[model samples]
Target chain A: MRKTFNNELSKMHVRFAEMGMMVHEAIFRAVKAFVDHDKALAHNVIVRDQAINECENELEKMTLEVIALYQPVTADLRDVITILKASSDIERIGDHAVSMCNATIRMKGSQRIAEIEVEIAKMGDYTCSMVEHVLDAYVNRNLERAYQIAKDDRFLDAELRKIRQRCMTVMQAAPASVFSGSYYISVATYLERIGDYVTNVCEWIVFLQLGEIVELNPSSKNNL
Target chain B: MKVKRIRIIRTFFSDAIIIFIFLTVIFLLVIRQVRNGSVSAWGVETFLLLSVTAIILAAVDIFGRYLRFRKRKQNLEALNSRLSNIIEGTKGKHVLLEPSDPYYELSQSINAVQSMKDMISKSFVTQQRGYFSLIEYLTIGVMVLDQDRKIYLSNHAMSDLIGREMNLKKQLYVNVLRTYELSQLIERVYQDRQDQHAEIKLDFSDKVVDAHVVYVPVSEHHFLVMALLYDITELKEIERMQMDFVGNVSHELKTPITAITGFSETLLQGALKDPKALKEFLNIIHQESLKLTELVEDILSLARIDASPELKLDEIDIRKFIINLLRPFRPEISKKDIHVEIQIPNGCTVQVDQNKLRHVINNLVQNAIKYNNYKGNVWLKGTIKKDSWFISVNDNGYGIPKDEKERIFERFYRVDTSRSRQNGGTGLGLSVVKEYVEAMSGKITVDSQVGVGSTFTVIFPLELPTAPLNESTK
Candidate 1:
């Protein structure tokens, strides 16, 4: 019976990893679509969001089943609970990827905001890396790495502030670009939100280890 | 020492009291005899006798009691020292006593208890040895950590995985496991008192380890965390290759299907009404469909070869086989004004499956003709070796680039897709040639230089095996 329980736990881990890769791909393509102004790629990213949600549901169900049948306590219980919560964070990141795509679709064939696009792209890269590292930390149970990722979210936060400033300056300098400028801001905001969710994942990693829910990014506390 | 002295004095005092009581009884008896006039006389001689006897008897009684007290005192001292030695964790012998000794029964009981302890401890040591040996020989890496995240135990596999011998006892887990991911996993198990799991790529080595961390509750208040590492680098590589294959296949199929659908849609929309343009559009559709057909057929043939690699052997005249294989490509060769040369010994025979060998020759010859420049030369040469027949196809065409030679046989791999498409070449032609050549107990290799020429040499076994060999062995 213990062996069967362990097998189920391993299966849950594999599912979570698969979900991580899927979300990573989605965010990557979503950012590329925005930068390249590819409507079809954006549409594909939007369509793929349902798969992420479905994967999240499947992971949650498996976690619940393991808890109910095994009635595991201590570390076993902590593992299941961590996966259950982390999957939701990952699913939210996937949603933000779709939002990124939606923002891309809104500003179809407009004058490219070169400076802001560059900033958003940087922010996108940071957010994707955060998602990847945090998931790895979760899977590996690397507490120190989880802590490092939590700290890295501060960098993304700073980048978000810089992007906001640039978007405002561009809009103020030229009124005609305000139409596309607002969409760029929305994209940046979505990326920042995605970074926040990644921070939440890093927090989950801390919780999984220490059984403590810590607010790792202090600056984001008021917003939360 | 004081207590023993007091005990001896107390024993002497009790003995003196018993003697005194005896003397009083004797005096009373004498007095009664004298008063009843039963004795002749109460004389000085009789009194002297009674007094001397009583004195002697008291002396002997006191002396015997002193000897017994001394013996018991010595026995008690020896037993006390031995018990103290045992309590202090020293190996001490049990005090030996004769059956007649005063403390013999106590000495026997102490010895019994000591031996029982020895037996229990020896069994425990043996069991511990067995447990450690079992873990040491296991193939999977195992590490145990205490609640403080200190390394308690590790096996041989753990050392191999870490790429070093580790003295892990009482050492913090992070100090031993260099990977941050693994250290954190151990910490998670320790803090949460639950089983955790992770896959870690090692920084010190190029190995991917799948770690399963589990919480072990030794008692109500004591627990340990165990991490098991399984190397999964090979599995990961296989998974990546499978994914790449799927991606490449889909991409390859999508292009032709898109072209066919798009061109046909253009024709149906209005181009068909324009008679002059209709023929050209129809021809493009037809060519794309043919390419698609060739691609599917190549894929199916590869699948068949993979599923069953057994070949049906037939003896073929080399000169005749070369002529028959090049017959279909003769028109193309002549159209391109390419010179064809066949240098095969007459009456020389090779054993192979006729149909599969035909496919191999057909692909090589077709590639030679299609890639040849105008008025270029194509050579088909056969030679006999000790155990094999070497067939070489030489083409003086725009030769393959140096870097692309190795990947030319990969499915759907084209160095220049537009050029190949314009020349009506399906990208699967070389890959199919490679697969068929190998399926017939042969090996294929290419020698090419850009702007010079290419020679594709296929070496077939002189005699194909009569019985099927295991596919994997080949």
Candidate 2:
């Protein structure tokens, strides 16, 4: 009986990894579209978000069935629970990436503050790093990496703040340039939120490895 | 693991007592019915009754022992398979033990061992996985160094970053990294057990990488260090190229702008009174403006090449193309008193981008004419291979130095800067030729001997990809 349960758990693991890859691609393509003014890529990211959602639903169903049928305990139980939590975090990251792509589509062909755009790309890089590291932590079950991922999120947060401050200063100098400047702020905000969702994932990894719930980034201000 | 207490002696005592009482009652009843029978006369019947009771009790005890032993045998088999499965990292069959099985406690212990094995094997697999398989796909190179400052594990990405495949296990960290500062950084991280990130240039290829050294505590006292090396060589190259390009363009533009302004100012400051001086000054200004215009146009087209470049392909006879390309160069060819030889077959034809091929021919032929000595020999050859075609332009000109051969195709790089500037060369022809050639999926190479001669070859693939490559911005 436990043999069947373990099979189900491993299947959940594979599907969760697929969701990880999809979210990673979405985040990557979304940032690329925003920076390169690639509307087609932006639309692709938006459309692929549906697949991510479906993957999450599939994973949740599988996890729930395993828990309901087998009633796993100890590490086995923690494995499924971690998958449930991490999948939700990954799904939310996909959502944020889609919204970022939306802003990218809207900001297409507009005059951008060049300096701020460069900073936005840097912010996007940090967001990608955090996402990748958190997923790595999950896969390797590395508690240290989870904490590091949460700590490194501070870089993304600082990048967003830097973009915000610079955008304001530039807009004050040339008020008409506030159009793309606003888009930059919104895009960076989405990246920041995505980074936070990655932190939430890191927290789930901590729960998996240590079997405890500890918020690594409290200032992320997660409501639920 | 539950086992019920079974007392053979106690159960046998109870059975014998009941049988004895029943048989004794039967014997008493018989005696009461008999006319003159005594208890001694029924000795054989009593003995037979006792023998049957003993036989029945012995039969019951043997059957129970046989059933319990069979169960124990089955349970032991299940436990064997279960234990083997757990040891092999697979889900094992349940060792369902009957309460009376002798090794029920043994099966229970296997269950405990299985769970512990699960945790242990899971960690081991993940650790080895991160060391080899998982990190193999990562673009960032990862290496783990043990407490003895020796290589514990590394992935293919690390070998790729190091520019060679090597036996990385058990090697010293300093030997593998080949950067003293990086070794020092690892030492500092080990001392403080803090994460440190630095930009270090590898000694092998001089690639700049972000060396993120993390102090990974393996256990309580013993710790290892993990270095995540993210190669930013391409990024640094792009940044350096952008900076160099900006600086070069500004300098290239400023040279002529300064001359135009300087001579015009002189012309206004009384040099305009002398008729010859006025005419020469105006001519200098005109020439400088023309050079400036040429430079600007070259820079603009280079930018276009950096964009999505298109190759207008056509089938052209190689001989005819060359003859047509050399038409405008005839004056320079004759002025240099050079003998031009075209050793190409009459039927050599290729599917090529016409204008791009023209640019390639123009640049090489123009350079040959400009650099050749008086009566120097210049030869051109075209050959069609099975899968590729190449055109070689050979000239007995002042050849390039071996050190500068690679940089000749770089933008704004000129061999004889003074001579080319005086000849009104924009120093962009070879680089432009390179761009045009690459747009048509071709390569350019040069073989030169400083005083002997130089051969510039342009080779193109016979077949073209029907679909355009993915567009990447420069």
Candidate 3:
């Protein structure tokens, strides 16, 4: 029975890594679309988000199935629960990358302010790398790296705020540039939102290890 | 193991009890004979009793002495404790037990032998340590798995190659080596017991390694599989880039040459009499010829550099250099109506090959002009950074795709095929720019966003790197 549980868990692990890879590719391609202005890659990331969402639902079902079957206690229970929570957060991350792709699609042919664009790109980079590191931390159960990634969320947030301020200035100074500037603002915001989801994944990792719910980035925002 | 010079034997208290009973029996018999006072010939009974007592006494003495000597050496723990002190070079242990003791000489010999074994084993351990360190410090990753497929040993390089902590021992190789390709390769090696070589991808990242696994047999029943992994990710990347270059060269050559041949063949067959067709065909021929010349010139330049690439370095002010480089682009810049902004600090200078730098700067400036939207802004900022100096060419134009970003420097790689062809780009622009930058001991990086624009930065170091240059020199 223990072997059965372990095998199920290993299968889940492989699935989870696959989902992580998919999300990673989505984030990468989404950023590429934003950077390269490739609508096809943007549409691809958008289409791929459905698969990611399905992955999350499937992951949730697997966890519930493990709970129904083994009714595991302590660490075993923590493992299933953490994965369930973290996979949801990853789905959210994929969703936000989709939002960036949506923003990329909408921003088409509008004038781009370089200053705001660079900040938005910076946010994309931070989001891409954080998702990568956070997934690794979860797989390796590296609490220190998870904590470092939690700290990294603040940088993404700062870039988001900075881009918003810059976009506001661009909007006021040149009303003509506001169309693409607002899209840039939205893209940065989505990246920051992705960073929040990454922090939540970090929280699940901590809960998996420490066996208690703890917030690595305790923010008053994202309350909704 | 050292052969024992002295044999070991142990006697128990039960043997002492049996000996006591036999001596008592002899005493009783003697007592019975004496008490009975049998009338025998003179002193015959007396002589017999005396001989019996003397024989028994001699037997007991020999047995007791042998037991005492053997018993002293019986405790292996005592011998180990004695030898440990000697091996440690401590003064507490004596080579010879107290000289007054009956078995002191025998103990001395055993102690001498014990110390000799200790020295030999100690040296063996040090030699083994040396071999272990050799594997530990090897640049190529090495792992040895026993027949059970457990990781018998792995080095630091192994961990670095896989980008994981794998210093653990006796772990199943599959558990440590996450990639299916690597694990399957190891399994194959174990099954065939033959040497195998492969290029395996690390699943998480695009890291490639040249893997060589050897089946090492220790005995009939025992064997090991040794895997040597050297990271060839960079090498594979260069190989791919060169392959793209070669493939592009053929494709680039074929297109215009085919157009030239077809147009000329059409003119030769029938169209010569029709002035309109003649003029059109000749124009087509002329255009294709121009393209052919451009391609040939680009190819020859690359070949010249490939033959013996040299750098002639000189110090030039950055702001002045950029403005001068932008000289050729002024007419195109105005035609595109680009808002060219140069924010390089005055007196900012670098030592670089002048002609090569001119080519590098010109390629970037021309790209900025070609790819920009009407009234698009071109920003050039020169900054002297620690360890390196850089000038970034930032443009508000259609940016490169993320996937194609890595390949953009490859010859004939165009993000937008139609746009580049429309713009009359040979696709060799970035490739030549990259080559010249590397030849001048520099680096280049591009950051771009789809609709937003692109930034191309050419960086040169403050100090020459001691290590050799990249794939070009090789």
lDDT, model 1, position A131? 74
Question: Poorest 10 consecutive residues of model 3 chain A by lDDT?
Answer: A215-224
**Tens-digit lDDT string for candidate 2 (B1-474):** 333346555666666667667766776777767845566556777678766876586558756876776676677778888877876778865576666667878888998898788888899989987757777778888888887667887877878776544336886554334344465577688668899999976634547898899988779989889888899988987786677667777778998899999999998898989999999989999998998999988878788887867777799999999998889888887887899999999998889888778878988988888887777889999989999999999987666755458768878777766667667677788888988878777788998644446799999888977767334222
Instruction: Give one digit per residue, the lDDT tens place, for model 1 in A92-150.
Output: 88998999899889887554455676577678777776776776677667899988888
DockQ of each: 0.02, 0.01, 0.25
Model 1 chain B worst lDDT window (10 residues): B172-181
Residues A45-144 of candidate 3: C-alpha lDDT, one tens digit per residue: 8987888898888998999999999999999989988888889888888888898899888887777786666667667777887887887788779998
Best by the DockQ measure: 3
How well does candidate 2 score on lDDT at residue A202? 86
lDDT (Cα, tens digit) per residue for candidate 2, span A70-177: 999999999999999889989999999999989988876565566776678778877876776677667768899888888988788788888899999998998877
Candidates 2 and 3 compared by DockQ, better number: 3
The number of residue pairs in model 2 that clash at the backbone is: 0
Clashing pairs for predicted structure model 2, backbone only: none
Clash pairs (backbone) in predicted model 3: A35-B449, A35-B450, A36-B450, A37-B450
Q: How does each model score on lDDT?
A: 0.78, 0.79, 0.79
DockQ of predicted model 1: 0.02
